[model samples]
Target: MDANDLRDLGWTSEGPDYRGSRFHVRYVAHIATHRQGGVANLVTDECRDTRYAERMLQEWARDALKHSGLSQAELARRLTAHLHRAIDRAAVNKMTLGKRAIAGDEMIAIEEITGFPAPLENADGLIKVPMLDSLVSAGNLSPREPVKPEDVDRYVAASGLPPGDWIALSVEGDSMDLVSPPGSVIFINRADTRLVEGGFYVVAIEGDHGTTYKRYRASPEHFAPYSTNRDHGPVIIDDAFRVVGRVYRTMLDIGPHASRRGK
Candidate 1:
């Protein structure tokens, strides 16, 4: 399915980050199926490699045709009749053999014709990032410390993240706005805690003001919000404040899906 179809099915795109531009359609579909106590019919591996997708498409097409008991000619005739597209036997052979790139519409047509799942349903190369129990505030700094690994209760399949100690934190408010809205999942590189330059970071203050997400600049130690919401002001990082982790990537929460925890 295309992005529009995924969105219609309550899936949202978490755009390109360190991994490249891959949609989280399989992940969302898994969540939807899980919530309904149904098995996810699509492949949900977090693979981003193009060659893998191509191979998967070819395999799925062959399997679909074999299971449907329809010969290439019959399938092509049916596709042309139902989709009003000139998909002949040769075109079907090329797609099933992985010679031609399958367009989104054609894939949809194939799924409709063969009663098969979407070919690109599996996530192949994504690593599951742990979601920490601790919450980071996007509105006001809350008094919470980063938790240990034992405190982690969930995992999120993500790509494009730099290799390092990483953890996922949920944004609690809209203080960061466009960059990270409320309920967004932010990935932090735990090993890169030392301040270097101006970028987003999760910081903890000594006193009542706890962890917060903000644009942090090192030359002049201070943290500020990118949001136009003036309720929050810039905070000067002093001896009492500590850098928790650098925010490298984020996944937007599109609906009521719980983070998948490690079993």
Candidate 2:
């Protein structure tokens, strides 16, 4: 793709944070393996050299445009038709400037229009699991806006997780720290909400309050916090409730932090 036009789909001042975000741990893992041409450590310093990654994209777009025999404006027109989005030559020019990011869908459209091989292809055949861009409280029930099932904060590669209604949520408190600590991103299968005895589940007693991450104890059928911090106790949910989902996997904070990019 000749770049630009549609918009700066993934541009972020903090980093390459954008819609259909490709700046996750799993995203880096796939990059590492491809860059090394073999298995590589996915967590070594996050493997996110934004400058290098952008440079590669810049070069790829330039070469693809040159080889396609399509002018930048023509390529933008093709992209607009393929994506059914308003794309102009200026936006494509911005894509070549290394000052923005491209979302997965945007990149896919470019690949099709330019006939260039996919730079970020699924060479590892990893599954794309959409993640929540925000955090859910694990302590008190902090109220939050409703999130539609289709809102994807980012995409993470899941080699182990089977395809389903799996959504990822980050935690904000220490209440469920034993299993999923604060700052951890927990993956929950929305389709699998049937509470199993002693299994972990996210619950909400009120529509206005944010969901609580807890372990269900069948002894008295109460939602119990799993933290060593006893200040957070078990909640005997009396009101009619909803099980948001059951968390099956968690990615713990494994390194020094950076501010996450999302709305």
Candidate 3:
């Protein structure tokens, strides 16, 4: 099971709570035993082996340096002054290059200095989801297809989403308006394809009509618009309509000209 699965079962990184309100002795024991086993399993898991971990460390260190906009010598000096840890440029290079393993204290110091998680701890609370190349229309129908890995623009890390299959889609129109404006990115939980009352969803119709985003309601099925201008009226849902996925979250693009017309 993954970290999320363990969390669902009440396992915490703060360690087992034998005396806590929700705690059972057996549950605590199980957590301890399983956590150890899980660590071992993760170490052996594909893409998380020793080599990958070293590469991840190197990449994170380099990324941290780049993001900090500080030279190695300057960072080393700052680390020594602020953290009160006498780590020199040579030591930083050696650690970043994977020539030396970063100690726990050093990791903590680096995290404090850079305001970024250490490589070994980076994946603790993040889920990586693919950003699809195809745009989902907010006003008109757009062609939809199964997303391949090669078609992914990038992998985006998200948190607090329900555990399920998810895909990212770029908004193409202002139909979703304030909720998901054009140029915004929406995260859809593909597993939640069932029609639900009073929820925004990506939907498709039969034939070559393609897909569009709409606020859906069941019982008297229809695709309702939330736009103020009301350019499009409510579309009556029929047997031809298919609920593709639910829009769980939206990342708005608040660029300089985002408020302008046809943006």
Candidate 4:
């Protein structure tokens, strides 16, 4: 795929400070474990001196596998069972880069196996420096101070998403405590709106400050947004209401610092 052609397929550049830096998104095939080699390969950058690559790989695997319907326990079981057949980081890394270098008919065979074309032309990922202070614009979080999107990025990165693909936000209340705790750092995908019911999401609604987070409850009459803390109650649906996006992932105990990338 041509780099310029990627935009047609929803690919774009991303970086830690989308507001301040210039970053490019590189697209690739989403891989899963294979019996031939059980590890899903996703990146090709030479490991070199970057010990952090392992952590990045682990996190990406979690997100990719989870999205593929493999539970954490199930993933562990599979890895343990396929340890011998499992592809280690070195081999997987090579595979990712090789996949990125292929061309023509070869790309088709690779795509069939990975569900993504080889020499992947353009980026399929997106990144933006989310406004941290808006972490809890919801009524519940109204009392807290804002955090930085870059700091949230690091926290979310440790949670297993590419830094360019994650955004941090503060928890407004306990409405999502079954999963998200108050003040926890939330890593959200602005494009993921089809969140599973009963799952958590970050919503925005008309508020004194602007938009805020709410537990998403979809129904015929309205997109019922709720709060975990009973004191907050549920905000019913209306014609003007909309779901900004779903909370596919999140993190906690993020260190107090801004993301330092590019410079």
lDDT of 3: 0.68
Report lDDT per candidate.
0.67, 0.65, 0.68, 0.41
lDDT of 4 at 142: 24
Which order, best to worst by TM-score? 3, 2, 1, 4
| Residue-level lDDT tens digits of model 1 in 1-263 | 35566557664455322132344766556555754654554333333356788888888888889878899999999877654457899998998889987765466567667887654444333455667766533213222444455656555556656787677887766688778766678898767777767788888776667777888876676888877588988887764876677899876745333322111
User: Ranking by lDDT, best first?
Assistant: 3, 1, 2, 4
User: How far out, in Å, is residue 242 in model 2?
Assistant: 1.1
User: On a 0 to 100 scale, what is the lDDT of residue 249 in model 2?
Assistant: 89
Weakest 10 consecutive residues of candidate 1 by summed lDDT = 254-263
Q: Lowest summed-lDDT stretch of 10 residues in model 2?
A: 1-10
Error of 1 at 124 (Å): 4.6
Give one clash count per candidate, in the order shown.
Answer: 13, 6, 0, 9
Query: Positional deviation of 74 in candidate 3, in angstroms?
Result: 18
Model 1, global lDDT:
0.67
Question: Residue 84 CA error for candidate 3 (Å)?
Answer: 35
For each candidate, what TM-score against the reference?
0.47, 0.49, 0.51, 0.37
Looking at candidate 3, what is the lDDT of residue 178?
65
Q: What lDDT tens digits, residue by residue, belong to model 4 across residues 115-223? A: 3322222212223234344544322232222433333322212223543333556665565565656656666655565646565656555544235565555553323
